[model samples]
Target: MKKTIIVLLTQLVLGLACADTIQLETGSFVTITLPSGWSANLNTSRSNEKVYWINLISPEKNENAGKIALDRLKHGWAATEEKFIEHMSASIERLSASLKEQPVSLNELKTDNAIILYQVLVWEKIVSMITGAGLAEYKGVGVIHIRYNSGHTAMITVPIKTLDNSNELNEILNIAQNMQISMPLSENKEEESAQSSIQITQNEHGTVIGNPDISRVSLLLPSKNYKATPGALAIGRGDPGYFIGRDMVANVIMSGWFSPIYKFKYKTARDLWKKDTPKQAKNLEYLKIKEWDVMVHELEIPIKTQNTLQVTLRANLLEDGTWIDLRLSSMGIASQRADMRKALIDYINTLQVNVAEARGFHLKYTKQGVIINAPAETPGSLFIKTKSLLLQKRKTHIKTEFFLFQDSGEDIKVIAWLRPASDYHYANVKTLWDETRATLSGEGFTVIGDTDCQKTRNWDVMLYDLKTGDKRTRNVNMRASCVSGGIWVDVHFTTVDQRDSSFLRSKLLAYLKNFKVSDSHVE
Candidate 1:
C-alpha cells in the first residue's frame, strides 16, 4: 500500500532542514518553505481523477484555528483566469451552503502568472453555556491559482487571518510563484514500487533484514556461503540479508518469529496477498505445507551489479503473530536463470526454522507488586541496571521501576509502574487509560492510532501507541490492573527507531501476557 507523508515545518524553522523537497507517493514532487507550528500532509487518493493535494494545519487554540489546502488538478479545466475565478466562486458557494451563512469576498488580485482572492466568513463561536457567553469570529481565507504553461494546473488555499501579521504569507506566495510540478520518470516509479513491496524502514542498526510487518519468525539461512559483517549479529547480519547462490551470486534474506496466530488479520494466505499485493508483482499465489500457509510473489528490484534483479518473496504469518519471510533474488541474466531457479528450490527445501520461545528472565519485586518475564540478554544485547522513580497526581504517588534494554548501539526502556489501589484516579481500566493518555499528552506526546483495551484472566490490559511532536520518537505503553492486588501496573516500551518499534512492542505484549499478581504481595 502507498504510504502518506506528513512533514512538519518546525524542522525547517529549527534549522534541521534547509528547504526540504518532498516526493509524494503518487510520483509528484512538492517543495515548500514555511514557518514553525505548521505541518503538512500530502494526499493523492482523491476520488476525482487523481487529484493530488497537500493539507496544511496551523497551531490551534480552543479549536482548530487554521486550515489550508493546495491541490494539483489532473484534467477538465480551462487555462483562462475567468474560469479559475468561477471555480473559486462555486467552491465558496458550496462552503456557504454547508455553513448556512453567506461569506463576502474582500479582495482579488489577477496577474499574468497567478490569481489571488481573499474572503471573510463571520460566525458565532460558543464559549460557555454556563456563563451564557459567546464570541463573534471573523475567519479569512485566501485562494491562489497558479498558471503553469507546462500543462500543470494547481491551486492553493491559506488562512488569511493567521498570516496577516507575519511574513509567512509572503513565504507562501513565494511558493506559489516558484513552484514546479512534474511526473516521476518511468524507472523511478519501478524502483519505488520495488522498495514499497519489501516494506522495510532502514535504520542505523546494521542492514535491516526481512520485513517489519512480519518480524516474529527467523530463518536458518545457509551460513557457509554467507559471512556476517562485523558487529551486526546483534540485529540482522550484513545489510538486509546475506548473498547466496552457488553458480550465480544471488541475494537472500530470511526471518521469522513464533506466535499464536497471524500478525494483523487475513484468515488465509490468499486473503493476505489480495489485501496488499503490489501492482508490479508477478505470479502471485499461495501454498500450504502441513501446518503452514505460505504466500508467494515476485518483483524486479534494482541492484548494484545489474539494472534489475527478479526477486521472489515467500511469506507465512501465522500463530497469532509468528511469521516467516524468505526473499531470493537473481540478477537478470539469461545464463543465470536456470541456476537461480535451482538455487531457490534448494534454499526452500533446506530451510529449517526452530520454533522456540524466546529466553526471558522471570522478574518480581517483594514477592508481589508487578511480576513479568523480561526478555533475556542475547548476543550483542544486555539489560542495564534497573532504575526507579515516583510520579505524583494530586496527593497520590505512583512508584515506577524500569529496565533499559540495549541492542547493538540502540536502546529502549521497559518501565513498570506501581500505583495505590485506592488512587480512585485509576479505579478502572478506562480511567487508567484516560489518566495515562492525559499525563503523556502533558509531557508532549501524542497518542497514535486507536488505544486498545482487552481483558485477560486476572487483569485488564490497555495498549497505547504514542509519538512526539516531531514524530521522531515512539512509545508503546501497556497498562494492566491486577484483580486482587492493591496495585496497578503499566509498562512503557519506548524506541526512537521505526525498525525496532514492532519488535519492542511484541516483547512488551509478551510481558503483559505472562504477567501475574502474587498472593504474598500487598500494596
Candidate 2:
C-alpha cells in the first residue's frame, strides 16, 4: 500500500509538470497539444481551402463558451481569406465613419501570414439565482488571436484584467513575440494577395506645442533636431537656429531687463510715446506677460503632397523642467486657408508637456510670469518668458528669457541674461530697474539702488529673508559689457546654509554637464 501511494504521488507531480511545460512551435507544419483538462474539437467543413483546419478548444470550465463562439464564426463566413480581410476592413471603416468622430490615426502597420489560431479564456463565478440557489456564471472573457501567412504570423493573447495598464499591455506584446507557434500552416497565398491589394502610408513631423496636462507652453521639437542650453539665454537661442526642415527657417532672440513686468512697461511707454499705438496694451497681455518665464516657438510647414495624408508624431525631449507651446503658420501657395486651419488643429491636439523624466517639475503659466514648481527636495526654481516672430514668407524667430531662483528662498541667484544690442536704442533702463525692485519687494527682496542698474552698466542681485523684510546684496556686476553683438549673463549664488549650498552647487554642475551647443547653422 505504501509503494502504491508513492507511485500515485509521482504521477501527480509528472502531470503538473507536463501541464506547465507545454510549448507549441509551428513554422511549416502544425502540431499542438492541449494541457491536461483542456480539450480540442476540430471543424471539418472547409478542409481543402489552403487552410488546414479550424479547432475550438479551452480548459474544461470554458469548453461550452468556446464551442458557442466557434459556432458563431463558422455560420457567419464561408469565404476565402482575401474576402474575409476585405470584409473585416470594410466593417471597421463603416463603424468608424458612422460614429462621426475623428478616427484614431492608425499610424503603424505590420503583416504576417504563417499560421492562424483563435483562443478564448473565460472566468467563472458563482452568483445567487433568482430562486435563492447558487448558480454558475461566466464573469469575464478574453480573446487570443494567432495568424500565420507567407512565412510570418503573430500569436497575441489578451489577459484577463479589470483595467488595462498600457505598461502591462506592452509586456503582453513581448510575451506574444516570444510565444512559439507549433504547427505552421501552409502559406496563405490568398492572405498575401489581400495584403497586396491594400496600401498604407505614414507621415511624421515634429513641432512645438503647449501641453496643458503638464502646464507651461513649451517647445516640443524633436530631440535629434535641437539641443538645449540650460542656463544662458544665448545658449537657449541655439534651439531656434537648429529648427530647420525642408522649406523652413527659424531665428532666436533673448532679452533680459530688471523684470519682464518692467520690460513690458518700458515697451508700453515706448509704444505710447514713440509709436502712439494703443495696441501696446494688447501686446502687454502676450509680450512682457509674466507667468513662469516663457519660451516661444514658431513652425512653418508647406504641404506639397497632392493626396491628403494623415501625419502622426510626438516630440522626444532631451531635458526636463521646461514647458512647451507649439504654433504652426503656413506660407506659400497651396490652399492656405483650409490647410492652415487643419494644421493648427492637429498641432494643438498633439501638444503634450510633462515634467522631464530628470526633474519632475510642473510648469505653470500666468499673466505675471512662467512659474516652475519643482517636486519636493528639488534644488531651485525657474521662471521663463517666451515670445515669437514670423518673418514674411521664409523666416521664424523665437525669443526666450529664463530667471533662476534658489528654492531655499534665502540667497538670490541670477542666471545668464542676454539682450540684443540693437534693442538698446528703445530700452528704458530706469523703469526696468524700478519694476524689478517692486516685483522683488513682494517676494521679500528689498530694492537697493534708486537708479537703473543698466544705466550704470551694472546689474544688481538682491536677497531677502522670509522671517524679516530685511534685504541684502551679495554681488553686483557690470552689464554684458564684454558681450559684442549678443550678450550672455551668468549668475552664481552661494546659500547662507552650507547644506543648501551643496544642493545649489550640485544643480549648477548638473546643468553645465547637460548643456550642449546648438548646431543650427549646419547645412
Candidate 3:
C-alpha cells in the first residue's frame, strides 16, 4: 500500500506541472489545457484587403502532434454571405494541398453549446510553412480539422485519442467552438487614463512681453489691393536699423501685422487739421484718391483714422543687463503733413523692450554705435553707417544723415556704403566721394583712389581704398547715379585685423544676400 500511494503521488505531481491552459473570450468564455512541454504560436494578418487570425499549438515532446486554428471570415460580409462561404471553401482546398494532406472524412457532432462539423486528416509527412503547419500521424497521433463561420471563419486542429471513438472527438469540438476571445477596448482605456495624468507647467515670472529698445515706424501706401513690397527701411545684423536677435525682432514685427488695424494716422490727421482749420473745412471740396475701390475725399487728409494700429512686444533676460526693444508702427494713409507726423508718433508707441545678459563679445547697433563691455574680445569695435539720398533730375539731392559710434577703446574704424545709381546729386557727389575717402583714411587704410570703374547702360561703378598710412590701399567702390534700382549701404568693422576683418566681411556679405527690406526678413 505504501509503494502504491507513493507512485500515485508522483503521477499527480507530474500531471499538475505539465498542464498548460489557453483562454479566449470573443463572446463566450472557453479554455483548453495542454501538456506543459508544448509551444504555441499566434499569427495575425491585416491589410486593406482582409484580416485573419491563426493560432498553432504543438507538443515539444511529440513534434508531430501540433494543430492549427485559423479564422478567415470576411470582416463585414452580411450582404454577401454566399461569397464568404465560397471563399472559405477555396482557401481550405488550397491550404490542404499546400500542406500535403488528404482529408480522411467529414463528421458532424452536436454539443450543448454548438453543432460542429470536423474533417479528419492523415498525412505521410509534416510540412512547415509561414501560412500553416502540418504534422504526420504517428502510432498515437491524429489530426482533427475543425472549421466554423460566424462573424469570422476559424479552423483548429488537435490530436485525437487513437483508441477513443467519435464521442471523445465531439467533446473536443464542443470546447473549441465555445471558446471566446477578448477585445482590446479595455487596454485602450487604460492607456488614455495614463496619458491624462501628465501635466505641464509654464514659468510666469521669467520675462515680461512687449518691451523694446528700438522702435519702428511703418508706412503703408494706398494701393488698389493689399500689396506687400520691401519696406522703406531694412533691419538685420548689418542693416541701418539692424537688431541683434533677428528671430525675436522678426516675430514681434509679424505679430504686429496680425493685430487689428487701427486708423491712428487718419485720427491724428483729422485732429490736427481740425485745430488748424475751421469746422467749415470739413465740407470743403478736396481731391480724391482711389485704393481698393474705396475713395478718400481728401488728397491729403489729416493722419487720423479709427482703424489705425500699433503694438509693442518686450522680453527680459536679466535684471541689469542690456534690454531688447522692438517697436512696430503701422500708418495706413496720411493725407497731410500733420497727419504724417501724428502717424509717426502713434506708430512709435508699438515699440517692444526686452532685457537680457549679453552673450556675444560686444553689443553693436548701426544707429546707436558699438558698446564694448568686454575688453579681451578680439574683433574689437565694429561700426556701420547708412545714408539714403534722394536725387531729382540728376542734379538736386537730399542727403539723410545716419551716425556710427564706438564705445571709445579702439584705435581703428572701417565704414562701407552702397550707393545706388539713382541718387546722384551732382553738387553733393564730390562731397560724398570726399567724405568716403576721409572716413577710410581716418581709420588707417592707405587711400587707393578709384581702383575699379565701369559704366553699364544703367549705372557707373568706382572703387577706392584706405590703408595703414603705409603702401597698402584697400580698394572701395562708388557708382554714379541713374534710374535703375534703389541703392543700399553696408559698413562693418571700424577696427579689425586680417582675421577679424575677414570674419566681419563675410558676415556683412551674408546679411546683404539674405536680407530683405520687406516685412519677410528671413526665409
Top candidate on TM-score is 1
Candidate 3 residue runs with Cα over 4 Å from true position: 1-104, 110-115, 130-150, 159-171, 181-523
Q: Name the lDDT of candidate 3.
A: 0.29
TM-score of 3: 0.22
**TM-scores for every candidate against the unseen true structure:** 0.34, 0.19, 0.22
What is the per-residue lDDT of model 3 for residues 1-523, given as tens digits with 9 covering 90 to 100? 0000001100011221222322221111123333334344333332111222323333333433334333222211121345434543454565465333463344555444333555554433322222133223322233343333333223555544353455434444544565442111112333222211111112333212321221112222121222211211111211222222112222223212101011112243333233333221222222211211110121221211322222222211111222122222223333333453343333333332324433322222222222221113221222222211111001112432122222111212233333333444544435555665677678665654334443433333334433432121222223332322233333333322223333433333333332122111111
Cα RMSD of all models vs. native, in order, equals 21.9, 28.1, 35.5
Q: What is the clash count for each candidate, in the order shown?
A: 12, 44, 64
Per-residue lDDT for 420 in model 1? 37
**CA lDDT, every model vs. true structure:** 0.41, 0.27, 0.29
Better of 2 and 3 by TM-score: 3
Cα lDDT, model 2, residue 208: 42
User: Which of 2 and 3 is the better model by lDDT?
Assistant: 3
